[model samples]
Target chain A: MQTFHFDPVDLPPGIPAFRAEIRAFLAREMPRDYPAEQKANCWTVYDADFSRRLGERGWIGMHWSKTYGGHERSALERYVLMEELLAAGAPVGAHWIGDRQTAPAILRYGSESQKQRHVPRIARGEAFCCIGMSEPNAGSDLASVRTRAERLPDGRWKINGQKIWTTLAHRSHLIIVLARTSPADEKNRHAGLSQFLLEFDTPGLRVQPIVDLVGAKHFNEIFFEDCIVDAECLLGTEGQGWKQVTAELSLERSGPERYLSSIALFFELLRVVGPSPSESVRQAIGRVTAEIWTLRQMSLSVAGQLARGEDPYVEAAIVKDLGNVFEQALPPLVQALADDGIHLEQDSDFVRTLALLLQTSPSFSLRGGTREILRGIIARGLGLR
Target chain B: MSEQRQILADTADRLFADAVTSRRIEGFDAKLWQQTIEMGLPLLLAPEADGGAGGDWDDAGAVLHALGHHGVPIPLAENMIAAQLAADAGLELPSGPVSLATRVEGALQQAGTRFDGKLLGVPWGRHADAILAVVPGHTVLLRRTDATSLRHAHNLADEPRDDLIFDNAPAVCGPASDGTQASHLLALARCAQISGALEAALHKSVEYAQTRKQFGRAIGQFQAVQQQLAQFGAEVAAAMCATRAACRAATRGDASFQIAAAKLRCNLAIGFATSTAHQVHAAIGFTREFDLRQSTQRLWSWRTEGGNDRAWADVLGARVCARGDQFWADLTARDDAVSLT
Candidate 1:
């Protein structure tokens, strides 16, 4: 039996100072009059100015080496900053993808020239990146992606495909596209796929907005019509997109962000519930808090594993799966507890936040790999599939 | 894991595997309890000068975890709590098994060095040499023999949860210096213990599912069963993390909202863990003849022993509400700032 390894991780001495620093920075810089529902939408908030400010403070790429314009802080310090930012509902989406995924991906597999070209800009938050993995047909079954990148005679690649659910693609400066570079093998569909770092401004590329349930234009459909990319654009070796993307998903999965999505709503619920709450209300709040705390611990443990250079894919999946379950469960539970029948309006932050969360939180499980896909990963990890 | 902690855990694991078994626990083996006491587990959290191992809460949590993993049918956690309370109060530590109580149905009133009241659900009270109760400003340590009478009871695990009455019994009382409330201490202990039992349940369920075949293949190969086990794994992991974090707080004598949250979370986890384990094993897990009943039943029993989920939830929810806008700050506060509201 392969048990999940969520060993308890003690925060290092640097975490407290880092936490205070981030909290203070958020206190000073965060928009104070935003709607409470906006707090629940913190992760999706694309404030390039705030992101630039964070980068100037060297908070964006603290874990990266100073040679790449990073501060060379520990992973735990970065984790503290992330948790504080998420908890404070700080807008961090502008440079989030680039800082979290693109920088590391470039550092790990990019050429020396590619690293020098992109890594420093990413650390400086001067550039933004978006994931170009999911397509209309390849949402969860990623191996079925049909976006083809053909080898050109001029030592470049011509890509022709459409990517759906491309978050921030409309604004991102770069997009890490996963395309089929060769014919797919019948027995191994994961083969022949490769990753490419395509500049978003490339010719024949288009991004169209898709409004979500909350009437927010956060995601978009990206079209690549014979887009040309130089040979230097490939992220890793050809036919290894499956492995590289799988690794990247780990970075996307296990984080405080997974569970803290609805935390701002939670705090608003607390404020509305007031000092005296009924037994059921108390239990409801307690249950959510317990679940979040546990998920945070698990996420931190996975972070520790990542810091130690061990791939905790299964462990990360479990954290995301469970974290999503709790986050998704919070809105309904709070609604049932409030039982106020109050209309959603700006006058009542609690009522408005609750309504927004109730409508939007269903996507929590659907967004970061659906519940079924995550469970499949867990099942594979358990050697059951 | 540190070197010393690993050694302690390894030793405890081996000792538990050898001495504590289904047959021994089903038969209520006194020798197994004696062996555990002889191994110096009961005094693991006590000071060295008081005939203890002088270990911290993390080491004690490891021992309790080992005992819970093996489904040891003794009040080892209770004993450790009693020993620590006694030692912390500068009182003489007594030999043999001891049980600690925080929520007695009847008042255990204290006057000078005497106490009078009925202690309900006193774990291992029938077998314990003494009972330690934290009342008012003092920790009252009273002998079981001094009790007027004992009404023996059993939990789902068939462990002793006796009711004892003390009619103005003499006790060695000391000023409470532990700072942590008895409920918080016991909650922390049960959190660790339940985490271990939850792990064992998941471990056993996964093993059983892999070997137990269905229509064509192992039931574990089925997506339904695998998903259930995966959910169980999540609960177990959550319980482990929550308990360890709460234990860290308890070790620093900071009985914050975390203790209540951990207790509530772990109790809730045991519900899922036990149900999923039983569902995975089906008939075999339901029977006492099999080893699954030991872990599941204890999970059922231990969850309510030290402040059940509802009780602890109220504690946490009230504290969070009281803190009001400071909820996040308090939740993320350092150990020194985490006293019970």
Candidate 2:
């Protein structure tokens, strides 16, 4: 593991300068009519063309190699870029998963030709990808997924079954899916699973948006009646899908995204409330700040570990488990602080963001594996499981 | 910065785990107490030649963190705090727990006729060679073997929190701490212990949340309970950061505002984390059969022991007000080594 020369959360001098460059670029191309609220932390409302703009600037694949249209930047540089984007509430949501995680996976585990085929387009944000891990019945029990992919005569794969809770499926160009390629055996339930990279417009593929509790069409149920892909589209070897997807999940779970999503709303809550806080509000905010700050340290530590090319699976689980708590806490704390006649959408972008966050906060703990699954991982790490 | 601290912390963690869990710590464990004394933990503040440990706050912090982590039943923190105070008074480190050598009369006025003020709840006082007691303006060291001791009652968690009546027992008297010095050190020490207990408690809570599934999923998956775990996680981490930082300051002999901040943070973190551990786990955490109670119960007692949220907040408020008057440069002095790392 690479020893962290300093805290991973602290942006390097090279990156703060990079931040200035990106800010200037965003100020210019963000479109005067851009949904400014999209720039608030996790509340980034999806805008396809805007995300494509980011891809065109090579901002989407900031850490990928230049040979792959990636900036070949240090992980710390990526850290700076991701935090700034999320903080500004950029509408990068359309291609976030693909650019931040899927592309990274392809770069590391995909064949060289596969990297050449997808990396550049991903860098330009023209190609978007969605995660297909959560199925209707196997949302948290990833090993129990029933979506099946079978090898056909022509060496192509015929995938049949359904995937649900696939976020932003309607807008993405492609999806990275986890499928069961074998029957469940006496071994661990995770055995026999496989992964596939399928195009959105594939002959048998269908996308139906899954409206969340807040009535947003951000997530969807993707039906694979007979979705077919060439053998080259397999994410990894058969039965190796479990390991590859796990590595991907760790990347998905460990970033600064988990916590920063609520920071904008939090700052808004403070501003809408007042200068001097009530005792209860003061205590709650103090407690919340302490937790968020500590989790940031833990998350950054994991980032440092990852920068050294460490998997940090357990650390990532810890951050996810802790982050859900932080995110979930914000809605109620915001409500409690703003109980004095403040509305979720009071003709202000800030209020609208709070409304959206309140509607979205409940899923914070449910998405990306349930709290129990995460705790199970953490327990095993602590030797308690 | 030093490996010696890790050695001391690891050793103490092992011994305390064995002793506390074994129920060998009856307010104090004599043999283990001597082992700690031999480790020179008590004389950590003493000069190297004075038969003391001569370690810094970082060293003391490691020891305190271990004592908390393992739920050491004895008042190791209190004894250590007293030792530091006594040593700073240009005196030799007495063997065991000091009743803080504070005036029983004043404590009685505060306690409203409940001030028999013998060193009850005193760790190793049940086994100390001598009890450090302070009269109106005098600090006295009295032998425990002199029949000058009286017993009291056991506390809620059964730590032997009785009373001691000095009645001017034949003892060596020195000088009392002029004002709130003893109180401050005592509160800071308690905060450190509480931080450790919170850490242990949160760990137990997380384990339970992951393992105990209902409705076909671990209860932790539920948003309500996950919120509890998350809150405790944050508090536990915050308390740890604060407590360790404060312990660092105390060991350096600086005892700055950061110490007060640490104390305040730990007080709230422990209070909330412990209560939530019980709430989230519900019946399981409430039962004495589990290890969760061990840490939570200790936290409950420690909250009221050295100080509570209100007391620490007062200290925090005063410190902030103090800074409000200092020149901006002084208040935000860069490299104020006293600031937490």
Candidate 3:
């Protein structure tokens, strides 16, 4: 049976300085009075200007080739940039998907024309992308997607289906839709599925925002009614969508964002509790800190694997699974250990951040992929499946 | 892994596999100690100029991991640390088995080269030719024969953990070496052992899951069983990674944070790893005849040894909290000695 490997990775030289640069940028750009509650959901807080500033600093697509408007930095450098942003709770939502998933997918599998048009715009923070993989009937069983697309004799592709729980679809400039180009084969449910890149302005596309439990409108339901796109819109091979999307998911799952979601609240907890805390509180903080520190090492190991061009999907799944549990548990742990000075009724930063995270923590495991799905992936890696 | 380290690890693993028997689960195995001494395993961290192996902490970690994996009932880690400490202090080590003790009760009084003190929880104290006790600002090497009395004790795994009382024991003493504390080294040793033992338990659980039948199907086929094993695999991976980080940090200087984090992380993983391994095996695992008990019992014993999770967590947490807003900065300031390609 294959075993999991997460070799320790040391950040290359100059990374410390690069980290300082990002810290300086955040210090200069982020508002001094930015509320902790908003920072708790910073990744979902869209700020086009903030993203553009990062783009200007070449932080977006910093690892991609300069041919596509990238700066051609190392993957470790990009990792440092990303982790600093997440750790500081900077609003990176506007171009997060574009920079993280879309540009990478395009660079790896998109047509030259697609790369030329989308990669630069993404790197420039002028375009935003939302994934359209999850459907109303296909939450975890992703291959059960009922969205269908047909190629017309005139060479344009027509798409018809609905995608639910699509984050930021309403505000995104583009959508990467996974559709069945042909009937699903009984022996291979994953076959015949194709990915397409479409502009939000497409005539037959409609997006409706869905309010989350936290009253956020980032989640959306997208409908594709006879949406037509040119043949160049096909991403990668016609029927290799499963392989491509799973690769994207690996990139999605292992980043620092998975575990650092509640970092803002963690800092707030430290701040409110002051330098001297009770033994129980200190123990709680210590436990959480140990987890965060270890998770960062795991995440960095995966990042190093990616840099070395090795597929560590199983390792990534482990990180996401462990990270999701840690993120989801942070709020309640803080609530259980915090002093009585901080309560839900109070409007203090600690209280507000704690409340927001408590409401949003459930989605920490739900988004990207659910805990069950990640464990299934890990089990497969362990040769149990 | 480097080629040299890999060879050392393989050799250690083979030696440990040969040494560990169902009957020798407790106490020192003299033949195994003889073989290790012949192999110079105890001098792994001593400088080459001192006629030692000149191996670094990483090399020692690889061997220690193997020792733990096989549940080798020996004081290899303790002996290695003792030899390295003696070498660093320019003290000549004794020929036979050497146990280590960092936590001594009361003061280790030194009057013109004679020492007196009580060493507590000393692994293999009665079996060792000499015992190395690290008191504040000094490391004293005392012959076991010089002890006034010995109280026998054992951990949950049945390994000898004795208390030795020394009254004006003739000893070789030297000033404590810089950047090498007996406690931190011992903690790192425990972390490496926990890492290896966790992996062994995980391997056993996975193999059992694949073969054991339930409801006319392999129990591993069940989603419930698969998920538990998957979680087990994750804990094992985390322990391994954290231990590696700690080893690497120790190879560099000032590894207080990494060591504390790694030990705490390993301590936390032990609970889940032991429970899940036994849970997956069900009733068979609970039997003393089952080999799974060897790894689980060691894991249980090692978790509390070399400082438990609460102790390390309190240290790590207080340090970070004391840093206040600089917590993130301190966490990110990497002290790794290697460069990424």
Candidate 4:
């Protein structure tokens, strides 16, 4: 049996001061009365100015090389900055995709021209990017993506397909899309797929908002009707999109964000429970505290593995699987333990936060990757498949 | 792991494998205990000046993890703790198995050089050469043969958890040293044990799922079984990380929060790990003859040995709640602020 390794990772030197700096930045920038409801979905809260401020601090794309406008900081330092932001419920949506997914993909797989064009803009928080992997039919079976990018005779690429659940696509400056560049191979469905980078302002491109149950319009559906781009837009080698996108997922799945989504609600719950709580309430609080603390350690361990240039794909999947369960279970557990006033007092900060999380928490397991898909990955890691 | 820890872990893995084979899962295994003593395993945490290994808590934790992983039936963790506590208090102990008791039913009255009290749930008390108890202000070591009466008991794993009564039993006493409390050390020990046992259980379940056929194919092929085992793997991972982090934290300094959190997380992992292991293994796992029972039963017992989930949860939750808005700040401050080499 293949065993999972999450060796304990100590935060590197200067992390405490780095953490304090982020805390101070958040305290200074974020309003004291920032709505609790908004904080519940803080990462999805788009604030261009806030993201720009973080970029100004050299916080975005922190682990990348300085040649691409990155600060060349350690992954652990970036981890500290991220957790501090999430804990404070800072709005990081505007640069979230670009800094987390696009810039890294470009740095690792993109040509020098591609990296120079996108990575610097991303580090400066001037260009926001949205992912284009999922389609109406390709949710978890991402290998079945049918979006096509055909190389034109004139050495340009023409794209045509629809990408669904593309977060903030309408507002994003660029979209990194996974499309089939050739006929799919019967032996390997993952073959023939390629990734393309396109500006949202490109011709024949359209984005429509998909409102969620919480009335949030962050999710978007992008239509590529022969969207044309220069040949330089093709990311990495042709037909290696599967490998490239899968690599990006380890980054997406293992970060502190996976577990800290509902931290705002947690802090609110603690504040409401006060110093002295009933035995049951105390136990509830303690259970969640332990869960979050352990998850943080697991996340950090994965981060350390990544910094050391190890591919911790299975470990990353485990983190997301456990983290989503912890974050998703928090709202209801708090509801059962908290006073009924949360249900009646809709205007109160605690109630508002709890209500928002109750609706949004379901998406925690749905987005990124479904619980079933993540489990499949972990099961494969266990040598079960 | 450091090279020193790697050597210790390898030594422990070999020692436990040779000493506690599958045939001797239910009893003390005196031959194994003798080998353990020969290796100076019990003095792993004692200072070098005290004629001991002088290893740190992480080293001891690595040994305990191997013990639990192999389902070794011995009081090695207890003995290590007892020897270390004795060394810390400047008290000399006999070179034999020594069980530790942090939970005393009543006060250990010290009159001159004798002591009287009940040490509750002393692990392998009847078999131990001596029992160490950390009282209110003193660390007291008493020979098991001096006990007035002994009520022998066993945990779910069939490990001895005897209660010993002492009435004016001749004992060595010294002032308790500052640093980690006995209860915290015990809890951390169990965390390491549970973390190891969880891995064992996960290993068993995954192997079973792959081999045990159902519906004309391996059950592991089914998404349902795979998902369950995957969740089991995750719990095992969490337990391992939490235990290792707590042990590392203990070696540095105050680890109240890490120990409490580790114990609580390990306790939670035990529930899911054991249940999932059984569910995946089906009837073979439920029987007494299978080796899975060794790891699963130990997990069941160890979850509550040091302090149960509710106990540690209370400590951790109260601490976070008391911090109020500063909880995040307090949590972040727990990490060391050292420079990178």
List CA RMSD, all candidates.
Answer: 2.5, 7.5, 1.7, 1.6
Please provide, for model 3 over A300-348, each residue's C-alpha lDDT reduced to its tens digit, 9 standing for 90 to 100: 9999999999999899999999988888888998998874656698988
Clashes of each: 0, 12, 0, 0
> What's the best-to-worst order under lDDT?
3, 4, 1, 2
* The best candidate in terms of DockQ: 4
Q: After superposition, how far is residue B7 of candidate 3 from its true place, in Å?
A: 2.2
Per-residue CA lDDT of model 2 for A1-385, tens digit only, reads: 1111212233344543566687777667665765434555453366778888877776778778999888877886676567667655667687788877899988878888778998888888788888889887987778889999999999999999999887888888878889999887666887898888777888999888766676667888889997778899888678988898888888888888887777777556555445545566555544554454455555656776788787877667767777787787787777766768777557786677677777777777787778777766654554434
Worst 10 residues of 4 chain B by lDDT: B332-341
Candidate 4 segments exceeding 4 Å error: A31-33, B108-112, B177-180, B337-341
Q: For candidate 1, list the clashing residue pairs, or say none.
A: none
Largest lDDT belongs to which candidate?
3
lDDT of 4 by residue, B1-341 (tens): 89989898989988887765645657587878888878889888888899898888899889998998888889999988888888878899778788999877545454637887899988888889998888778888889999999998999989999999988789788889653488999999998888888988898888888888979999999999999998999999999999998998888878889999999999988888898999998888889888899999888888889999888888888888888898888777776433332
TM-score of 3: 0.98
Q: For candidate 3, give the lDDT.
A: 0.87
Q: State the weakest 10-residue window (summed lDDT) of model 1 chain A.
A: A338-347
lDDT of 4 by residue, A1-385 (tens): 4378888887777776677677777778886667777877687888888888888989899989999999988887887888888888888889988888888988989999988888888998889988888999999989988889999999999999999998988789988899999998889998899888888889999999999897778988999997889999999999998998988887788888898999999999888889998888888888888888899889988998988999999999999989999989999998888765457356888988988888889999988899999999999999888
Clashing pairs in 3: none
Higher-DockQ candidate of 2 and 4 = 4
* Alpha-carbon shift of residue A308 in model 4 (angstroms): 0.6
Q: Report the lDDT tens digits of candidate 1 across residue range A1-385.
A: 4367777676666555556777778879997676667778588789888898989899888888788888888897788788888888888899888888888888887788888888888888889999999999998888999999999998899999999998888889988999999998989999999999988778989999999877889899999898988999999898888999887888888778888898888888888778878888877777777776677768888998998999998888888888888888888887777677555553687887788888988888887688888888877776667
* CAPRI level of candidate 1: acceptable
